[model samples]
Target: MNIEFTLNGSVQKVTITSVERALDVLARQCGIKSLSGTCFEGQCGNCLVLFDGKPVYSCLMPAFMLRDHRIETTEYFTKTREYSLLYSELTKEGRSLCSSCHSGIMLMGMVLVRSAPTPTRDEIFRTLSNVHCDSISPDDFADAVLKTIQHLTTARKIP
Candidate 1:
């Protein structure tokens, strides 16, 4: 089936099989390599992407569902101010993350911070838990998320 959608700010019209997964279409047709995970199931956040301004596991999303939808990957998100805030916060204090999980964490952080600029630590932890990676401890994740929220809150107060 031929489907058209907005991918990373670009409108793309591509042909895909009815059974093709959104992840496959992204990597093959749109050339998005930042999405990867050990589990192809939705359990792992490795294949997370912004579907219609919300995070969704691309691995389980069928290509048909992508039609006319706006999808944003880490590749596109890295160009935004939110990405900058989350990236700097996540990498503070010599912390590091693998490419796949890094993308997942960054995207999740953006979502969390955007939706709730002052989320509780438990909420931050809950969001972070979605991305199953050992790169950072739970406390560390919450710390960075809180810091990002602080920055955004401070920025919003400015003229």
Candidate 2:
């Protein structure tokens, strides 16, 4: 069957099998390689992607369920102004994330920043606990949320 959905701001129609996972369809069929998940059962947040502007594990999502849904990966995030701020802030703080969890952490961070712009450190760490990545410290996640909130606040006040 064919699933019609928007991918990174483009309309895409793909033929996939129900048994096929979204990770495989996105990577092998659509050539999206940024998604990563060490735990295929969805324990690790490595293969996270935006499903209708929310985080969902691509590895665990069935391909056919993607019909009419909008999906965005790191490729779209990298082009976002938030990503720029995140990169700069992480670099300035000397907290660089590993490639394994980049997509998941970054995307989830974006969602967090957008959903809750003024998250406290405790709240930040609480959210960070949900994202399972050994290399990314809670402080690093907190910093990212702060940077993203700063960027959003600044962007809002520019007018």
Deviation (Å) of 48 in candidate 1: 0.6
lDDT of 1: 0.85
Model 1 clash pairs?
none
User: Per-residue lDDT of 1-159 in model 2, one digit per residue for the tens?
Assistant: 888888999988889987999888888888888876588987877778889987788888999878899999878878778888876766564666777877777777776776754878887776566468777677877887797788779889998
TM-score of 2: 0.87
* Structural similarity to truth (TM-score) of each candidate: 0.90, 0.87
**For model 2, the run of ten residues with the poorest summed lDDT:** 87-96
Off by over 4 Å in 1: none
Q: Write model 1 residue lDDT over 1-159, tens digit each, in one string.
A: 888999989999999998989999998888998887569888879999999998889988888999999999888867777778888888888888877688888878877777844788888888787788888888887888778778877898999
The global C-alpha lDDT for each of the candidates, from Candidate 1 onward, is 0.85, 0.79
Q: Pick the candidate with the highest lDDT.
A: 1
- Supply the TM-score for candidate 1: 0.90
